[model samples]
Target: MSTADDLKKLRLKAQIGITTVLGLVSIYILLTQPDNSSLQKWAIGTLGIIVGYWLK
Candidate 1:
């Protein structure tokens, strides 16, 4: 594969890995939190995932 193609594949793999981990963390955070303010953490975690994927 060309260098560019390799880079693209690497980026896609990174995005999938990071987003999966972040999603799990978000769920854990939401589930463990007693107060309803966990929504903020969810929102932020989602945004982080989005930005991370987008930047890839």
Candidate 2:
């Protein structure tokens, strides 16, 4: 009902959406075992970045 509430809702939505998508990416990478290490690194790095950003 207020600007602060709106902002909180927006932040929550963005966080959830980004996290879910990145999580799926990590799952996909794990399921489809890429031969190149870079893909695996990307999956790990992305999830790490998300966790680091949100948890902080």
Q: What tens digits encode model 2's per-residue C-alpha lDDT throughout 1-56? A: 57998999999999899899988988699678766678888888888998898889
In candidate 2, which residue ranges exceed 4 Å CA deviation?
A: none
lDDT by residue (1-56, candidate 1, tens digit) is 47998999998899779877777777777767766585756756686867776787
Q: Against the true structure, whose TM-score is highest?
A: 2
lDDT, model 2, position 6: 95
Ten contiguous residues with the weakest lDDT in model 2 = 30-39
Clashing pairs in 2: none
**33, model 2: CA deviation in Å?**
2.2
Question: Quick one: how many clashes does candidate 1 have?
Answer: 0
Candidate with maximal lDDT: 2
